[model samples]
Target: AWCCGAGGGVKSAFPDLALWTAGQRVDEALSTGATVLSSACPFCKRNLSDGAGNRNVRVTDIVELVAQAMSGRRMGLT
Candidate 1:
């Protein structure tokens, strides 16, 4: 799972800059040939997914993905 963008302070006040940062991350993810991108932080998830290319990559929370993989569910994990 990619940390996606710069995280924390970088994504708070400067969203456009954060998107650019996430774009760089997307390039790295594409190089890895990974379809799903997982992040622990909710803000990171939203920022990265929003900045990511259209349907080029799927973004999800790490806990949620694990639950899905295990055929289980997560509560209050958004």
Candidate 2:
């Protein structure tokens, strides 16, 4: 339940800080051994995906998850 760190103009005004914050949140998610991190916000998905660069985590939107589920596609680490 942590922020993806793309809020309050922090991403545009301070890219590095935003990335760092997003990375922290990603790390927290990784700690739980989660392979996918779903967000309701597009900005969060972008920031979190950027933060997850080179990692085994997949950052995606809830809508996409639903679409995949509805389509009967398996969602996993790729």
Candidate 3:
């Protein structure tokens, strides 16, 4: 699970703060090598998705992902 960063307006008010926070979260997630990074909020989704960079990780809303997963339609599956 990714921590909340944009709650304090870190991404919009301070980019470096946002990058640092997102990078830290991404590193933690990457350490697990999880294919999907799920979150509840839209800002967290944006931050995590952007922080994922070139990795195979994909960010998504938990509910949306769950619906897709239940339907057997994975998000970002092309």
Best by lDDT: 2
By lDDT, the better pick of 1 and 3 is: 3
Candidate 3 stretches with Cα past 4 Å from truth are 1-4, 74-78
Checking candidate 3 for backbone clashes, the offending pairs are none
Q: What is the lDDT of residue 65 in candidate 2?
A: 92
lDDT of each: 0.76, 0.92, 0.78
Predicted candidate 1 versus true structure: per-residue lDDT over 1-78, tens digit per residue: 555665767777787788888887877887888677788888878887877868478888988788887885543223
- For model 1, name the residue pairs that clash: none
Query: Residue 2 lDDT in model 1?
Result: 54
What ordering of candidates by TM-score runs from best to worst? 2, 3, 1
Error of 3 at 26 (Å): 1.1
lDDT of 1 at 52: 83
lDDT of 2 by residue, 1-78 (tens): 777789988899999999999999999999989899999998999999999999999999999899999999989986
- Which ranking of candidates, highest lDDT first? 2, 3, 1
Query: Which whole-number lDDT from 0 to 100 does residue 70 have in model 2?
Result: 100
How does each model score on TM-score? 0.75, 0.93, 0.80
Question: Which whole-number lDDT from 0 to 100 does residue 70 have in model 3?
Answer: 95
Displacement of residue 57 (Cα, Å) in model 2 is 0.7
